[model samples]
Target: MARPSSDRLGYLLVAPTVLILLSITAFPLAYNLWNSLRHVVLTDPSSAGFAGLENYRALLGDPQFAQVLARTSLFTVVSVSVQMAVGLMVALVLHRRFRGRGLVRAAVLIPWAVPTVVAAISWKTMLDPQSGVLSFLFGVDTAWLAGEWTAWIAIAVADGWKTVPFVAIILLAGLQVIPGDIYEAARVDGSGAWHAFWKLTLPLLKPALMVALIFRTLSALLIFDVIFILTGGGPGDTTETLSYVTWREFLVESDFGGGGAVSVLMLVLSLVIAGAYTRLFRLDRREG
Candidate 1:
């Protein structure tokens, strides 16, 4: 038998990995899409049948779903904006040549390194009405998780604390790769620090910013864990996000069809947002 060529061998090597991906990701996605198009209520298996676009129509007509979408959008915007701003500041500081810089960077990563569940639980404890440190500091016994607005704030704080470090590290890497000679050249041209940051640093940092934005936006849009653990979508469903609602449909209500519909919609929204960011970044690059 003739030996396989390099190109054929490369495909052969990757074939198994591709097969694994198809088995896990592609199979589940296809199954979900099928489920989304049919009624699949575990509680009423006898009535399960082709739903067509019924579930999608129902969800779109639901005021609660509209609220969930609005809330999720707000959360994504707020969380991502705050994370980017704080992350950029942290990255800038870390990019400086200060003593104990490495130690500081490692310390800054502690929040990101901590597991999400642990961070969420810790935040819950800290925001407890009676004995929480935050309540004591504010000099009020307000129940942070009992109020709708306060609950949102607490969730944002917890999410931002855990994720800001990751954004900072990514931005810091971007900053490191930026040739220092650019700054030197700016200095030679009598450019101020603020001017260079606006004109040079931000323009060059667009790629990294785009990356962090997409990741944070998607995570925020699908936020569940912190809300689940912290508030259980409490304060009268005020914190119930799209993911939480989907989970409720699948597990609580045993409505797989509805859950799959929500999941499909979420996937579409994520793709749209990601594509928008990518397109915007490419346009900015071209214009620059």
Candidate 2:
């Protein structure tokens, strides 16, 4: 009886936190669903009308939405791939000790620590056409943000620059945890550095690589702040992503119903990506 009462008290203690989470996250989700089913205009509350699935249908048929989805997929894939590759290289290079290695590691982390908005703005300045260093050094007058493909590249570079450090840090932790004696034993067996890295390092680093890739991929999928600051989803909607579309719908167009549909789509995409990652990684193997 006393144990049951103690358990009840513990539940009571955690109840508030649970309620707060529901209030913040779950409530909005429920509200969005409800709003999506109705024709609700923020500027005109009188326009509230039950539209059922019309908002969803409208969004699905919107060509602009399709284009945005494609752009988002491309951005996620390209940016995450580049970030992972570069970050892995950085981690491997930093794995070995050398003079000023510690200082270099700290300096590389500066991009990660900087605010996203500031980084985007800084990159924008550096890529500016007339007075930009890149334009001057390359001897080309290219408008990065004014073009569709260029805008995506700009966004990717900005996103990668900020996130590569994080991936390197995660991989570095994984590398440090690897037993040094394993390398020594491999060397005794006449395994060269390249062979050891391929056979031993790669195998041991799978979990960390998966983790880094997932983190970077998910972050890239929902990229918005940098793009918004840099392009505002302009250049003829060339760089518009899902999040950008949703923002424009809710804030710019003031169509809560349409925005709700976009939000639902985003949620679905996130779940699908998460499911795919889980299946690909076979995390169940670890459980067994």
Give the candidate number with the greatest lDDT: 1
List residue ranges in candidate 2 displaced over 4 A: 283-288
Tens-place lDDT per residue, model 2, 1-288, is 699999999999999999999999999999998988999888988988999999999988988788888879988887888888899999998989999999999998999999999999999999999988999999998898898778878888898899999999999989999999999999999999999989999878888998998778777888899999999888878888889988988999899999998898888888888888878778645764
For model 1, what is the alpha-carbon lDDT of residue 124? 89
Off by over 4 Å in 1: 1-7
lDDT of 1 at 225: 95
| Model 2 accuracy (lDDT, Cα) | 0.90
Candidate 2: minimum summed lDDT over ten consecutive residues — where? 279-288
Q: After superposition, how far is residue 249 of candidate 1 from its true place, in Å?
A: 0.5
lDDT at position 251, candidate 1: 97
RMSD of 2: 1.9
